[model samples]
Target: MKVLEKQARTVDEAVQLALEELGVSRDEVEVEVIDEGNKGILSFLSKPTKVKVTVKPKPEEVAVGFLNGLLHFIDKNAKVKCLPEDEILKLEIESEDAGILIGKRGSTLDALQYLTSLVVNKNCEEFVRIVLDAENYREKREDTLEHLALKIADKVKETKKSIMLEPMYPNERRIIHTTLQKDRKIVTKSVGKEPYRRVIISLK
Candidate 1:
């Protein structure tokens, strides 16, 4: 949260100054009148009114708050931890049944991550990427995909036939393409449109 203190002849004026500096609306901030100046004798020794204004918390703070409410609504006994690095927010879910959160092939986790990104970036000036994981599921899934890609490439080399894998999201397809890029006997390409797009491994 960003905080600022300002002083003017009136509390409203001080608040206005704070709002302009923070570049936020009145409803988006908390304002406290530190001192309502008194009109001294002849107004010659009067002090200016002072106020302290605080802007709303950062995106990470907002995201954590939202996740807490969401977890409670789902009745899931889990804890969310956020780590911000550069332009990406890494969120991890800790729970005894973490696999349930990951869902089949990490579809559920991807959906949750998308929603969280929307919530965090709504009305934000600069968008930040959100990466969600549960019990290191993302890393494990990447490793699995890389292994599958190599295995498929070997099969393609031996049979001299192209094999089209099941439909996958773009990120998953990228993993397959990247994993086989350096193989001399095989190549990879993505086929079809979104939601049904898949990777095809074939002999070079």
Candidate 2:
């Protein structure tokens, strides 16, 4: 949050000055009239209106700032672009070392997205969903998960034994579940607690 004080001939003028200086819209800030100016007797003595304005940084700005600092801390150079689509903010990171940022199974990227969302919606009145991706990692990961699900389902059918996959996040588990939902030969069920929960594939 940033605070600024400005004075003009009227309260509205003072507020406008503060808004211009802060580079934010009226709804993004809080304005308080510090002193309502008075035209003294006979107009000999006059006072300028004063206002105090407090501005909150927009969500996109916050997301960019956070990603920049994070990349710097990791000693990695990446280009981050923030795109606002309706109520969702899509953050795309492009870099030659995208693999490093993505980490194994995109766990690092997921962590970064989670932290970014927390920072962006910290003081917001309405929460916005943040979607973060690096070099199309999400789509690739989804494809890999769907393929693995089918492979595992085939193994389950042959061995007549239930196979429990490695633990995965809910989103990944959902991909597996949805991919095999229509298969009449096998069934998928999620088991265990989060961060350790996995999908169980068994022959029908």
Candidate 3:
């Protein structure tokens, strides 16, 4: 965030000047009226109005900064590319050693994304959702999940018995549920508590 103090004939004027210097609109800044100047004795100006202005951090900027800082600890060459969408901030981490950050089952990537989102929304009026990906892991994982769902559907139909899948993140579970949602012969339900929640596929 960039902060500045400006003095002018009035609070509004001071804030306007600050905004002009900062090259940002009023909505993008937090304005604090430090002093409402007053007219002194004999029609003399006592003190000019003073205001403190600070630019609000945009969600993308915050995400990039936060993820880059974390990436530095893991890999110096790692870089985060932010692609902003209407409702989500998409962060793509590119690194020669991306697999390290992705970790087992993308645990590390998800952890970093969670932290980045927390930091991004800490001051936001409307929460901004973040979609973090590394080496297109999310799409790849979705494809894998879809394939698993199809295979499980076949197994369930052949055995006439339900199969409970391994624990999955909410997103992964969503893939399972959505992948089989349209199938007439298969049904999917989430069971167990979080961090161990599983999808149970059964014959419809």
Candidate number with greatest TM-score: 3
The residue-by-residue lDDT of candidate 2 on 1-204, one tens digit each, is 799999988988899999998889999998888899997776659888999999877899999999999888774678799989988999999888888889889999999999999999998999989999998999999999999999999899889999999999888999999999999998999999988999999988
RMSD of candidate 1 to the true fold?
Answer: 5.6
What is each predicted model's overall lDDT from 0 to 1?
0.87, 0.91, 0.92
Best by lDDT: 3
Clashing residue pairs found in predicted model 1: none
Can you give the lDDT of residue 50 in candidate 3? 90
**Which residue pairs collide in model 3, if any?**
none
CA-only RMSD, every prediction: 5.6, 3.2, 1.4
In Å, residue 34's CA in model 3 sits off its true spot by 2.9
Provide the lowest-lDDT 10-residue window in model 3: 38-47
Q: Which digits, one per residue and each the tens of the lDDT, describe model 1 over residues 1-204?
A: 699999999999999999998899997888888999976787789889999999977788888888878877664688899988887889888888877778899998898888888999986778878898888998998999999999888888888899999999888999999888988888788889989998989988
TM-score for each model: 0.77, 0.80, 0.94
